[model samples]
Target: MSATTDGSRVRNLWDEAKAATLDEPGKLLYRSNLLGSDKRITNYGGGNTSAKVTHRDPLTGEDVTVLWVKGSGGDVGTIKLDGFATLYMDKLNRLRDIYRGPAHEDEMVGYLPHCTFNLNPRAASIDTPLHAYLPYPHVDHMHPDAVIAIAATRNGREITRRVYGEEIGWLEWRRPGFELGLELARFAAENPEAKGVVLGSHGLFTWGRTAEECYATTLAIINRAIEWFEGELKDKPAFGGEVVAALPRERRREIAARLMPEIRARIGRDEAKIGHFDDSDAVLQFVGSAALRPLAALGTSCPDHFLRTKIRPLVLDFDPANGDVEALVAGLDGAVEAYRQDYAAYYQRSKHPDSPAMRDPNAVIYLVPGVGMISFAKDKGTARVSAEFYVNAINVMRGASGVDDYLGLPEQEAFDIEYWLLEEAKLQRLPKPKPLAGRVALVTGGAGGIGQAIAARLMAEGACVVLADIDANALDATKADFAKGFGADQVRGTRMNVTSEAEVAASFAEAVVEYGGLDILVSNAGIASAAPVEDTTLEVWDRNISILATGYFLVSREAFRLFRRQKLGGSMIFISSKNGLAASAGASAYCTAKAAEIHLARCLALEGAEAGIRVNTVNPDAVLRGSKIWSGEWREQRAASSKIGTEELEAHYRNRSLLKRSVFPEDIAEAVYFFASDLSAKSTGNIVNVDAGNAISFTR
Candidate 1:
């Protein structure tokens, strides 16, 4: 329990953890979430944790501090940067203190700090104060089963005293919010030496000087408690088992984002963190149960969790005997109704004329005997935190009670926690859509080929696009087509070299001024050359990279600057060739340049993903119709190279694909739209191919 034990080794480990987190935060976050996944340290949207970073205020021109907490309902085990809410620490502190000293929590509406770039993120966490109160630069709050095992017992206070000897204090479980904060502050004052604290029948709190210390302490605390309980408590009959499978990060992110759409829509918050869990038999049993027997508790870790999580999770009612998922779903549906009725009844009982009653449990943990717990948030962070709390609570109880003594608060106590005014105040903030509208698009090489197709698509999808091409006549003609299809306001024409930075900058400035915002950039301009590596000329190499690789950097930089000034999260697309994926005979520079563009797209994607902007690449193989590559002269040249009729070359390429059809700009365009649309809300740093059958799989 002493942090100083093996101080040097711990410091070395923490230093390494800090290096990794600082060097590769995105990687660290995903890996951490993956590690916490499966074990149920957090559920769908139950908990959130954050590290404080210093920043300066743009308006005040003053130094200020900011903290990024998980977005509302995001799965902590699966959150990315977007899942975190960036709030001014000063503003957050004020919000927590405004109602202090006899002010009724609901008497005054609490104004939460806005997100960066003026976003009014809704629903500050139930545990926001708890997160802020930690002396550590980083804070980790989870509903760990081991911690919760301590929290959920009638003898929690006594056990905590015996275990930590006043090093940690216990808060009577209260619904999380201003009241929870006020109570936690009091506890902190009383226990000056405390490194951790337990909320009776709620969860645990821990913090450290750095992120690693926080993570390690959390693991140590939970594990220590687990060891204690295994020694002291009776082992229950084994039920569900752990999956122990490692889901790819992409898959996990996809799952979290998919589950959190509604919550994100409402809160304008992203969890910004993804955690993996370690699965144990207890977690599986908790999640696997069809019907949560009366033995299971009905509350979250604390009142504050209501903000991070929902009122309660949808207690999945399942029957292990049937094992029919549909039947299990039906049982869950029945359980949901009963839960709703109970929630309604609880609200009525808890409602005071002055306090509003919460409609449901902010989160509901399923106690499936064999299935692991699943938490659902409006977003993933919430779900993950809730799941973690359940996991920890289960662990804590397993250790605390030699008998299965998990306790749910009585209706009266549950009512007090539910109707706590301090918690309700946190929910008072308004949420808004991500402000990225009114953006203009200026695409390089956006005429007479795949570029033109991309330009047309961007125009149709709300961007006023100026299509640029080296071919002046082609630009004009394409503008006319865009006018016919979308409208005059949606399309513009320009003639410029993709390789010219000055031209790209000037064009970008003009577009921004004319359209009021230049937020989207499609660096889809490039020329192709076919030659072997040795035969590839300096001229070909330079020109190829100049138009494709360098062009993307030039054009994207202009767009990014425009977006920063406009305070918009822009979107970007790159048109990379299928050659980017594979080398072809007689096309060295082209393939190399194309591959470079793909890599550039990834770099840009990572940079732009958190900017409320998207970056992606489209690799199309032989999209020969209406493209310059398929223009009369080029087609004839290709035909000559193959020693076949131009018509025969088209057929050969068409038949070569798995789909047995010629790929067109339209084929690539559809996939581009998918990447651009709300449908691709989470697809960044990804390459989607629209190459008919594409010679083979798009991903290796």
Candidate 2:
């Protein structure tokens, strides 16, 4: 144990962990989970772990030494026994002997796959050789923020000597490959008593006789580095900028909202990109700082971060003094284009001959001064992850800067890691993305069961969503809930009373600001009413018409206006009721309003044809399992009107449909997704009934 070690704590955890897992790989998995669970040690999948073990070789009938290295693309936090690629140590050592002069990136990558002991298809990490070359039985390598703070500093070597003396070996900047492996092994041999190796401008490496020892050594090294940094860099500088305090928070949100949609559009997939603003104090400090551009230009804290954040963040210049939307959009367009050009140049200058196709040119992160930072990705999940990684990088850079000047690998070196075949393999493994990759959508009554379902579906298919509803509490709660799954950047909530033109107009304007522009609008804010035509009062009928009929008109009218402005052919889907097409007894007001909403959609379709806007309707009946529309009087009235108990009435509706299944919110959401995507590109002004195959509800 070193200076930072807490032996009792490590011993206790190890005792508990080892008691649960008697197998070696299982024990290694437990250790990996412990390391990965701490974000400070590794962000997302930025690190790897390994152990040396013996396994029976079926062909030779003898125990062989195997290198159990973490598999490529697996997060150590949740990695399982299978997540480790079992490699033959002797074969890996043989390949190392033949690695001569300059190590070829592709050759090393190719050899890794075939060197596995069990012919395991899982790709070993690119750093497998580095781990294999180590003499210890257990090894842990990580890019902890504290370690990067020192490694990325100007005086990294001197700092390393001052901290660990001859106990740690330091290697100059060498890209992760066979060469790095050789250099680290040579350094270890030269200094027999060295506790670990600190890769210059790279990361930390530690080894021990056992997994527990190695794990403890890593924590000790990290704690010492962090302690040294805190002691030496006592006075941290405050973040300052030309306009950090000059701009208002509201303006920052407005600018981010306005600029994001266009930025997403310029990146050029059909659906809009999801944008997240990291406006926390730390984020604001870094993004708003005067040194942001220069510090950000140094590149990511480590090369591994390049996978999630790219070489650098996209920084945009914006001022609230001038509010020309097009000009702002054009500026974002130019910046995005410049970023792509830079990426191409970076690729051409340093890419290996065998490197895979260049990754998406768009920067995953965008640094907005007044608005903090906005991260973008093809989907909500990635966008959030990118934001998290960037935030961590920002803090690391800040800490590094507090001491000696912060530094990272040169551009060419970073490009080598960014385009490494092993890294590219991770993206290739993802399932084909949804077609609506760059679209933004708005769902009214989003707090309702059907609206929530629609928002979930839209996000699942790669669209950012704005949830608008009159119930402020419900809207906020739903937004928070959805954000956990879809990302906070992709999901937002706005209080909107659809019947009021002012509220509708404001909500649409907010959508335009928040998402840059709108692509899909779901006019689903309506209430259910049931009464005989003679018994219907003006209050009941007007209330129903105002919500079901006029609400659709107001919302659609605003959406159409914004769609024309953006000139991106959009979709407007109305969630009318099955009662609209097939009148239900004693439900005169609800039926009439629903019928009017359907006709309104048709009229809008005709009007929007030239503008490339497609309007369609989804007629769903009795989506009552979670629907707010079926509560209290409406449910009782409908059951009484049908001359049956509530349960029997529900059963009658279920059996009435040809499919004999209840029409649920999810079923309607699936139909909505169809119209929103390219599947209904040529089809508009049509009503798709989602009432469990109810023939009577169908409309041509």
Candidate 3:
């Protein structure tokens, strides 16, 4: 098996489940987990698995056979037993007879819920009937990269026969439904000796009497396909050396940063869209191939991919090694227009009158030679998913090109799955997303308590976040936490000292190059300082001014520069303190610097209004929970000045406010979110106080 499949891990998981006296459904759960864990086999929520088991009929009190199959909206890798939809095999198989001619997609789908036998209310996968028609007790269906490499080729059927011989049966392209299920049943009847079946321009299906047997067979078959594909590619150049060599990493990112914003505008202007640049070796190699332009335009390797990635990716002509922004944007504008025009025509010709209208005609995957690939979507997770599918597709195509010509399902079949009611239901099921969906935000000092809280909130609202922090350790920890909660790719970390002009400029440049462009800039990097004017030294004053005042200026300055260049209105938020508006004894330096930061925001707000840029400040007080400044002797001295215990300071401040509530980091974050979001579109040059109704700190 390929390195992707870990037989030992699967065995151990199954063994542990058996030791716990797990049922057939539990075994199927482990089997699905093993297969789905391998991206080479299946992407997120892309495959289905099932096990035939005997259960006592609810009313009859008699043992009856049912198929426990992976349910819709569940990714097999992490799915639990509850994620499987149980259906009586007899009732599911009966659908094959009831629908004989044309695919009654809607009728077949509607019948599935009625046939469901389990108490679990979740809908079964659309491929449930296919599992029922199979004779084996366990079934595994996955869109493996290697099988797709051959299955999506011109000579796919011939290649399947050549590799697997009679061990595997080959079926022509068909949109999965009752008709396809019936066809598979017929093939099984004819080829009872076959261990698996390969569907053209679709994926592979394997079955056995046990979960282990089914999973093993899947890996064995995929391995043979991969081996054959590799053998065929022997001595191939892989990727043209000259093309990849032409674009250095920095140059590629520079071009990508400038290009993504224009692409987003061309695709849709109403909402912010996110872009992910995939310049990994595999992607770059594939994109730089001599066969790229011709083969890539053919379509996705499998019909399932057509939903996330379109039938074909939009290929741009601009070279990453040497391309001007204007020229690149011009080329992208033409390409985007052409792709949409062609998609509109395709939909008109192939779509049913009652089918869902066309989705955004925007291309999901953008293929740029030398620069690699970029996947665009309304959010980071989907963008990363699209990129993953395309990266795998490129490899499959590369391998297929060696054996035969790459071929995807015809345009009509793609349309069938693209607009399928089953697929549409998944999208409809998702709750209305937050308005920040697809927007990119950069939170400076993002690894701190307040910064981390703000970054988390922004990401929760569907914005892709870049955590820019001077502390490397905190930056990495926060990045990891965000990755686990959201996704590994949605949140990125950058080590930046905002006071350094070079670092600020480079960080903004890198942000553009890496994430396309920034939509929100939270200039919140600052250090707290406290001293009476008479006691304040040059060192204390400089330290406070450098980070609290100068730091905000440098970061905000870079943000404005990028915002103007992209021609996109943006938001800049400064995390000032209530001390900026109202003075406290022994806090001269800190108070004066924060006051400077607020004034700077006003200056930027005035200059930025013409560029659609909005600048604002969130003045928070006594947010000491996550404040590093409130630690050690500084915290003790500040508490001593108030003649209270250090821990009592929070409550003290809360009581001091009219609302009698302690101001938390998250309270400040909410204020920043308001400025960053469209809620404050008409409001700028403002200060929103988050001090729990402190009269002295109230914004004037």
C-alpha RMSD of each candidate structure in angstroms: 18.0, 4.4, 2.8
Q: After superposition, how far is residue 100 of candidate 3 from its true place, in Å?
A: 5.1
Instruction: Please give, for residues 208-261, the per-residue lDDT of candidate 2 as tens digits.
Output: 887778887887787777777777766656433444543577777766666666
Instruction: Give one digit per residue, the lDDT tens place, for model 1 in 473-575.
Output: 8888888988888766566777777678888766654453233345457777766666557877899788888877887788878776655543446567788
Candidate 2 global TM-score: 0.86
Instruction: Judging by lDDT against the true structure, name the best candidate.
Output: 3
RMSD of 1: 18.0
TM-score of each: 0.45, 0.86, 0.93
Q: How well does candidate 1 score on lDDT at residue 163?
A: 68
Candidate 3 lDDT score relative to the true structure: 0.82
Better of 1 and 2 by TM-score: 2
Task: Give the per-residue lDDT digits (tens) of candidate 3, residues 41-64.
Answer: 787778789888999998999999
